[model samples]
Target: MTLLAFLGVALLVVLAGSRVAFYGDALAEKRGWGRTWVGLILVAATTSLPELITGSSAAFQGLVDIAVGDVLGSTLFNLFILSLLDAVSGRVPLLGRLHPGHALALGFSLLFLALQGAALWWGGPLLGPVSWYAPAAFFLYLLAARLTFLYEKRRSLGQEERLARLYEHLEAAQVVRGYLLWGGLVVAGASFLPSLAERLAEETGLGAGFVGTAFVGAVTSLPEVVVTLSAARLGAFDLAAGNLLGSNTLLC
Candidate 1:
């Protein structure tokens, strides 16, 4: 029953996430937002909702191991999804199509991961109840976003008018309504994750880190996988890769 419940909830998360990707893509096009920026800022944020909620809740309860493990595990899992993309993306390498600017995301993810790992080993806080590592990670994330924005802007400079006209047919009210509707479903499904992880840990006599890495990590990442594959199928390769890498950066 526990495993069944996990699968059921995961499916819901995926469905909600696919809708999010669809509307998010349309909204971005409507607003003249770059695919990379939209994937990083908008779509990535929505898909990462589950991990953010679960990780925050775990941290609030002082389950630091679970929080850290889930974040790191999710990052690794998201990167692994790239391999899956490679398998499905024939002929041209998926990476070959991506803008070189994505190196910002990759670099930042590694930096944040290093910071977190070092914090665990160094064992002290630089601020009240918060480690020195936290602020560094946060700042790096901001820097990465800004850099990606500039790069995307430069790359898409000539296409501004074209991009703006692309989605003029979409009604704002309908798009917003769809975003909210699907987002609500995502929250509903994701809200069950932390408790599910706790229960799985208790039932299996597993450590928080192990359960977080192996089970919770995989389950929570369903949304990203679903969205990425769907995006690829639609030939939105940049959005697909950006969403995955962006989510990994946020997860860290």
Candidate 2:
């Protein structure tokens, strides 16, 4: 029953999450936003909702290790999705097709990962109860976003115009509505994951860290897997790559 419940909720996340990328693409087209930027900030955030909600739930339940493991494991899984994207893309190299701006996102992800590792090693409260790295990660993420925005803006002029519009029929309002609706569904489905994961860990007699990293993390990352593969299939390599790399940075 536990495994079945987990798979069912995961399926819900996948269905709702897949629509999020399309809506996000449409919203970007309507707003003249860069696809990479949209993939990074908008689509990636929606797809990563499971990780955020599950981690928060785990933390609130005093499963601190699970929370940390989920974040780290999710980030790792997001990166692995890139290889899957490459496999499905065919002929052309996936990395070769991506925008140069993705390097910036990759660097930030590494920095964030390093920071997380250091925090875990140096454990303790910096701001009363909050870890010192929390504020640092938040500020660094802001800085990464700022730089990415500027980079995308500079290169996006002629670049975006060449891509075909998949959602030309949808109005801006409609796109926003669809994105919000699906995003809410993703949130609803993800909220149940942590408790299910905890129960699974107990029943299976697996260590919390192992269950969190392997089982919980993989389930939470289903959205990313779906979004990246869908984007790749649509010939939106930048969006595909951005979603994976951006998700890693965001998980930090």
Candidate 3:
């Protein structure tokens, strides 16, 4: 029953997640924000709902290790999904077509990881009630977002008029509504996953850390996997790659 329920929820998430990718692409076109920007900020945040909810719940319950493991594991799992996307992308290569601005995002992700490692090694908070690294990471994320936005803006110059026509048949309001509606469904379905994961972990007799890292993390990242593939299939490769890379950075 547990396994069946897990699979069922996963299926729903996958279906909703695919819709999210299409709507996200539409939103990007309607807004002329570029696929990379939309994927990084919008789609990534929406798909990351599971990790956010699960980690917060675990942290509230004082399961610090589970929370931390879930974040770190989800980040790793998201990166793994990128490799999967590459493999399935065929002859042209998915990474080959990505915008160079993504390298900036990757650099920030690495910096965030290193900060996390330093925090772990220190074994104590450098700031009141939270590690200094937490705020530092947040600051760096803001900076990275700003820089990437500018970079994408410059690269997308004179292209907005062309991009806008891509979704001319649909109203901007309609696209936004569809994106939010599917995104909300994705979030709703994903929110229940953490409890289901915990139950399955108990039934399987797995340790908390292992279950959190492997089972919970992978389950939570199902949205990313489905959404990325959907974007790739739609020929929105930038959106696909941005979703994965941005998701890792967001989780970290």
Expressed as tens digits, the lDDT of each residue in 6-80 for candidate 3 is: 878878898999999999988877776778888888899988988988888899999998798889888888887
* lDDT per residue (tens digit) for residues 1-252 in model 1: 876887788788878878877777676666556677778777788778888887898899999887877788788888888788887778999888776767776777777778777888986667987778778778888988888887777766555666556557779778878877987887788778656765776677774565445766676777788888877776566778888888888888
Candidate 1 differs from the real structure by a C-alpha RMSD in angstroms, to one decimal, of 3.1
Please, what is the whole-model Cα lDDT of each candidate in the order they appear?
A: 0.77, 0.79, 0.83
Against the true structure, what is every candidate's RMSD?
3.1, 2.8, 2.3
lDDT score of model 2?
0.79
**Which stretch of 10 consecutive residues in model 1 shows the poorest summed lDDT?**
207-216
The TM-score ranking, best first, is: 3, 2, 1
Q: Of models 1 and 2, which has the larger lDDT?
A: 2
* Backbone Cα, N, C clashes tallied per candidate: 0, 0, 0
Query: Compared with the true structure, what per-residue lDDT tens digits does model 2 show for residues 93-168?
Result: 8888888989988898899999888888987678987989989999998898888878877765455565434566
List candidate 1 segments past 4 Å from native: 1-8, 123-125, 157-168, 197-213
Q: What TM-score does candidate 1 reach?
A: 0.83
Best by lDDT: 3
Who is ahead in TM-score, 1 or 2? Answer: 2
Candidate 1: C-alpha lDDT: 0.77
